[model samples]
Target chain A: MPGKTFEEQVRQELIGLRLEPSQQVWETLAVQLQQKHKRRRIFWLLMLMLCLLGASGWWWIQHNTDLAPGHAWTTHADNSTATKTTTTTTTPILPERIQPDTTPSTVISQTTTIPAHQNRDKNDYAGTADQLPVKLLNRQAPRTNASVNQSGRYTLPVGNHQKSALSKDLQREAVPENGVIKDQKSQPIPAQDNRIKQSVTAAPAFRDTVVISEDSKKSVVSAVLRLPPSDTTATEKNTRSADTAALPVPTHQPVDSTKASVTPATQSAGKSGWSWAVQVLGGLGGTRKSIGSLFAAPDPLRAYNPIGSGSPGSGAGSGGTATGAIPVVRDGASLGFEVAMEKKIGPKQRHLLGLSAGYHFYTTQLKVGARTAGTLLFNNFNVSNQTGYYFASRDSLNYTNYYHFLEAAVQYYIPFSFLKANMRWHTSLGINYLLTSNGLHYDYSGNAAYLFQNNSLFNRLQLNTGSGLDMQLGRKKPVWAGLQVDYMLGNLSKQALSDQHLFRISAILRIPLQKPARK
Target chain B: MQDEKKLVKDCLKQHPAAQKQLYELFAREMLGICYRYTKSMHDAEEVLQQGFIKVFQYLHQYRSDGELGAWIRRIMVNTAINYLKRRPQYQLDLSFEDAHLHPVDNHQPDLRVQMKDLLNLVRQLPAGYQTIFNLHAVEGYSHVEIAKMMGISEGTSRSQYARARGLLISWLENHGINDKKDYYAR
Candidate 1:
């Protein structure tokens, strides 16, 4: 009978060999694994924080909208309208959080008092004593009947039946350059005493009368109109009178010569809260060597057997011929795309804070010499192809390394005018967290060249800074298109062998999700 | 196969139980591989510990299309090679007489060589011969691959392997192991 060859016999015998290792090995491995998992937990925690920050920002926008003065009035009035009576009044005081710091100290006395019973009998008169307007009074006056309390807050007695007190602060805001009110067409209005009386009588939709006066004798009230929630298209006659009751006068600033400045400030306050914009960005990037080259081997290879040798060590022992110096190569290009939501942060709408989720693809190309015949090389596991093994037969082989990451980043943009008013320059800073990615590193150390997957090999988080120039496109609701350049500040990989950072140049387009904030 | 897939998935999630189970599944065979490369069981266990760490660290890279045990075995071989290369004591020097040898032609009627004894005999060879023989004859690597891994010419790898094989056969015959029963038998 024919027998197996010696090599085959040895392979067969050793293939089934098993020798159990000591228990200490597993214990050490477990400890190492625990430490690695701890780091992973921290990464996940950062991702969670980014999501929670975006969620909370969204919630704040909704909360502010619900509490707008107009919306709040519509809701509170609808609720309290049922308990309405002629004898009792309820004043809608602005929440302390929203109160302006420069509230005035003077109270306006009612100069033109109307017959309460006469208006009460009218069907159009929704005015109730329980729904009187907020009052401003002198801080120095006696606290007996109408003085502001010690903390400068005075709550009106709801059922007192006395007319609502007018704040001197409100009267000051109502008084402009000439101390008189005017219509939208720049036409001068009627005398102060009669206008206040006529405004109270003409505004039948008001459940409470709006009284604006500096004193009983000199009643100087200006007409600053805010359209009511109901009948937004009504004539200036009714809107100017009715909306005054809902306005919370800002405390500071000298009297403006023109009403244009005050009207827009009031309108924007009621209409705009947080303005969101959608940004679409795409860019090409490349990496620079940061710390060291990962491809350079730690030690030079020494050959056991020399070429044209009599014996293995005849001439190959100490003076072994060295392979040529390993060439230092730079990694290849990277491409990225992101869709983000930007929220205008300040009242002037000059600064924007944004949250983005994006895809970042990085590639590393190297010249791995020709693949030997009948040799197997490992590739990153591609979902499309079940097998990760491939043969490289060409003289020059490029390893198109891929890193697919789901990146979450927080970015802040500071906007300033550049060459013209229409062109804006925005400098931005961003903190990015690469939540998850495939870790594929090409290692040529083993018997065959294979792509090794190790998550700890790459840096997953980094800071980036950039600047962009945006040109306003449209006249009405402007669209902004810009060119942006971003530089990532650190190494791409955690390994000391690589010190490469990513830099990108991109085109960005921004469109407002809501109407642009009032200029 | 389904259980193995689940075990790999769980281990990727860093589940301690699944990790321990995966470790237990391959530890013995891997230690045996490590033992063949090192001088002592202690050194073998050290290589085993380091190799298993790499296995778990890179488990996610292991494509399920291939056998998991085979993937781990490759990593163990790499770790063992690195361990030997790093230490001064285990540094390989394969220089020896490149001479003609008589091929083993005698067929043993009855063979009774204990597996451990055979392993000892193989270990008794020089480190360079032992490594070249294991890489070529046991691991199924070609002379070209061994040459690339050890930075030697393909001709030298083939000659070294031939010398190792001849030495091992002579040692086997001289020990009265051929056609002998119950002599250090398993």
Candidate 2:
């Protein structure tokens, strides 16, 4: 073991150096917290609407998967029960059949085989101008039943259904695995009289068939496909037969809109999974005098010298005046909001965490001992005793409203590793780093006079609470309402009853949304 | 409070809990290792964090046949040495000798000190000698292993190891604790 002698002692020293930021930032953070609550409500409401829209879209997709032959498909096989038949022939390719998906994937089998050494010419991979005129031949339009040489790359658009018909003929013409080409059906279709589907754009997709199961009463055929490379010419693509025996190759080219038949893509995209939610926190921390402590009313000291018309009601008679040698306690209350982002981890199970930073934005009225500001000879001594000093702290003389705050946080979602049932709970422990806060100085017009701030030492405790209901939407999605609270252990000064630390609360709502994963 | 099997399992998963545990358990020892390799405390921390992060990322790759903490400690020492390797200039100018502690005569015994005192003396040695002395005397790695680890010849490692031990013993003898037991003698 190393550093054995110094580890504990050094760690203790380092721990003492932690940064506790200032509390003057509470005003900005307080306002931001309030805005956050409003935004969260709006967010959840929008999330709900988005979820409804996405769910409707997903339902529409799940139920509307078309099995028609001309509907298009790009890697579209996953527990799908659609019947697909692909034909290979030289006719102009279908123009409106391919809807290109932007996701990148490695399609293993979409390759053109070349003789080992003929590829010796670097140009073989990208052939020379004389070797293959893809530009000229491709412009010649598309043809069906066009025979490509066994070893040579085909440059023109091989008509769609013709590829299917030609494969049928190829079973008779060429022997299996032998690389032998029979000479029939080798003629290309003419440019002017092309009656095939117009394939203006071609995606490098190869469709292959594997027989899943076969019975006299039930026949199951599957076409496993991948998105073709975007560069390959339409004619160079081939349609191969599932078996050489005797099944007809159906000419199936799905329409453009049919490309996104992947179920998870549709399922993930049905609804917004997190909903917008909000919570409000309010507290009235007050002080009371026991009846036993102040049972009798005492005589008034000539506390107010009222020689003028204002002399009568200027005594110690406010809304709350506890009479006793016992300490007087002033009560105050604070309001705040909490907003959050939530994600579901399991079926009917959701884990959510929220951050809410706020404090009371209270208006202050300062009083000096029996004297008002800008006083001369008491404006003729009669009303001199009737006056009380009313001055905001020099620090807050211009804008005298006090606000509070806390901000920026990160949460650890612990429920992601397990499959919990109906329990939408997540407990996270993190530091609520407070931003810089402001103290408003009040002028006679009540504008901000100036601001000086420091981090409240007592603001460094855990603000812990839970909000949001665990809602189960549809069959799988989970929705949770958001609620949260914060507790700081510090308090303010003497004449005021509370400490420097603060507490806050808020709520949230989660809605399910869609994620388009595959097409 | 470390569990024998469960600790290994949790470490393998790179759980943050396991990381905190590893830190609490070995930070002291690793810091000693680091102090032997580096000139300053801050540098030692940098090396420690680097080594610990590597140990965590590769925890799953641990084959369960060996002691888990030992395996991680080896990684830490290597990481510390690697920091020296990248800055060859650190080794190039490593010529600092104390001129004041020579020609000591009598012996004063400090019987209150034990293994901890000797370890502190090892830490106060210069980086090169401290690392070699600790590896050979405490860690029990062979000269060949030390050579491969520090990217130096075995003879240099041998000579350095001998010199480190001689310096430690000489320091103790000068401190007046002459047991003549070759007590500081590795």
Candidate 3:
């Protein structure tokens, strides 16, 4: 047989070669694989949590946006009417009232009885007439007359525009009209027309009585008004009219009514008012290497040194001494409490400017050490003239720092709808002024005692930026809960003992003291 | 074969016992493969561990059509190449001097030189030469495949394999070992 080639022989010899690995390799591999699996599991769990939070936030936002537009419309209309009524009453003889009625003859005849009541309360009549144009009022007048004729039970016109304003007045008279008009229907058509005219003229007096009722009842009226116009029933109208008549009418009410003027401002404030919130935050903070420490001399005491010169307790030292001390700082926990107020800006009330004052406490432990060596010559000349010694000392210093911070920030809220709740992404940038710091404890051992001072050791200013999700809570949802993380820029340490980059996470509850009324 | 497919599926699910069984079945041969590309047994074992981890991590991507052993071997080879690339000392240069040629005598060969001895001889070659020789000769990768794997030209891979073979043959001959295996036995 021919001899195998070099390559062929080598391939043949090594092709099936196998070498066993030691048992330790398998153990290490198993541990690594288990750790990888654990890490993967943890990553997925966090992803799931994040997805849930996002989904809840989305749901909250959707609920709020869906109701906002309707609520805003009612509040604006009520506020504008209230203001218009007050202005019209104060200036009863305005030139606008003198302008010849340019309306059509049909509208003039329908509204001829309004001028007689207008002389009694100019503001109320003008407000009602101005809001209800001739076209709209005429359409509802025919309906009211037709409903009364058909039902003989004295059904009232449930016009959409007048429903909110007159529902309370009409509700008191509805029950009486139902009983009285049924009996009178057999008497005379002329008598029924006279009664209708009399009831229409008495509306202003009933409105005065409704105004004197509890302010809380006005919200009920506004809510009822929000219902679909077709759903208003004769019984509902009678209940409202009964409620109105039960109250005593005011003889001469003030032109600027408290409920009308105050309610609108309160409602508007609900939408764009100044709001305050208090937050308590706690987190762990780490100190980076200080710039001063980087440039400072290396600690000489780090290495072992033989005793050379002076006795440690001796009062006097003669020879040149070499000492090195380094200050080492460790990470610690931080606690903070803040009270902040925010005001809505812009037409959409999506921008907020806020100012906050807070107090923060940080506790840190520092280790300071020094190694020193020197030769001491004693004046007493008793034994040896030169005493050589080396001594090293380490001391732990605990510091609790209290800082007062004043911060101002501008926030933008991005509103999005998810399911039911109102949610907004609130992002902000702010500057923090360290108003004061206290409880800086300085303690050291041996030659390192001079490094720290109780005062002038920390920078008093920093800038921070953060973002979080704000979710509306409760039925009215006047309260909001926010989760935020703030990163403070710049160093905290003045002398480079530690760098002052701070990270803080906080859960915040915002209560609206006042909000701009949605219009 | 069905058992192997099930074992592979279990390993993909990260079943520890199945992973260990898979490791036990192939680790020894894979270690030998790693040893040829690396300079030391420790490095070979490290490569073997890392390659097995990667195999478990990416096992789901493995198709059922091919043999599991071949797939694992491919991963080990790629891992060894990567390990060489990561080392600061492993430079890809073809400036090595040609091995001195010695005349071969026709004689009865000694079969006593174990496979471990041949492995040791291969391990003694330069990192670049050892990698190319292992890929082409033992792993049966063509020069073109070796070049792509090592990020080098095909001509460079061929020349380095030749140098590596010449050097290994010279060492065996110097040690008085004969190549008596039949060339056409397969």
Report per-candidate DockQ. 0.28, 0.01, 0.26
Question: How big is the positional error of residue A484 in model 2, measured in Å on the Cα after superposition?
Answer: 50
Ranking by TM-score: 3, 1, 2
> What DockQ number belongs to candidate 1?
0.28
Question: Could you tell which candidate, 1 or 2, scores higher by lDDT?
Answer: 1
Q: Write the per-residue lDDT of candidate 1 for residues A1-519, one digit (tens) a residue.
A: 126667777887777789877676687567657756775785588468545744653444332211112221211111222122112222122111112113332232322112222222232223433212222211101111222333433222211222122233233234344533332222344333322322221121222322343322233232222222232222222223333222222121222212211111122222233334555555554454432322232211111111223232223223443221122233444555565655556786456666666766555443323222233322222222113433221112233345555556666655544443345566666666665454344333222333334556567787777778876553223446788776667656653344456556677766444322111
Top-scoring candidate (lDDT): 1
Worst 10 residues of 3 chain A by lDDT: A91-100
Chain B TM-score of every predicted model: 0.83, 0.70, 0.81
Runs with alpha carbons beyond 4 Å of true place in candidate 1:
A1-11, A19-28, A65-183, A186-425, A428-465, A468-519, B1-25, B31-186
Best by TM-score: 3
Give residue B73's error in model 1 in angstroms: 7.1
lDDT by residue (A1-519, candidate 2, tens digit) is 233332232233222221211222222223333443454585588568546755664564343222222223221111111122222422121222212222331111113231223333332222232222222121111111112233332212223543454334323332222221111222221211111111111122222222221222122221222222221233232211111111112233422222211111122221233322332344432211221222222111111111212222222122222111111122334444444444333453333333333322222222111112442222212121112223322211122223444443434343321132222334443344433333211111122111112223123333333222232222223333445443333332211222223333334343333322222
Q: State candidate 1's TM-score.
A: 0.35
The regions of model 3 sitting more than 4 angstroms off are A66-519, B92-114, B173-186
List TM-score per model, in order. Answer: 0.35, 0.27, 0.44
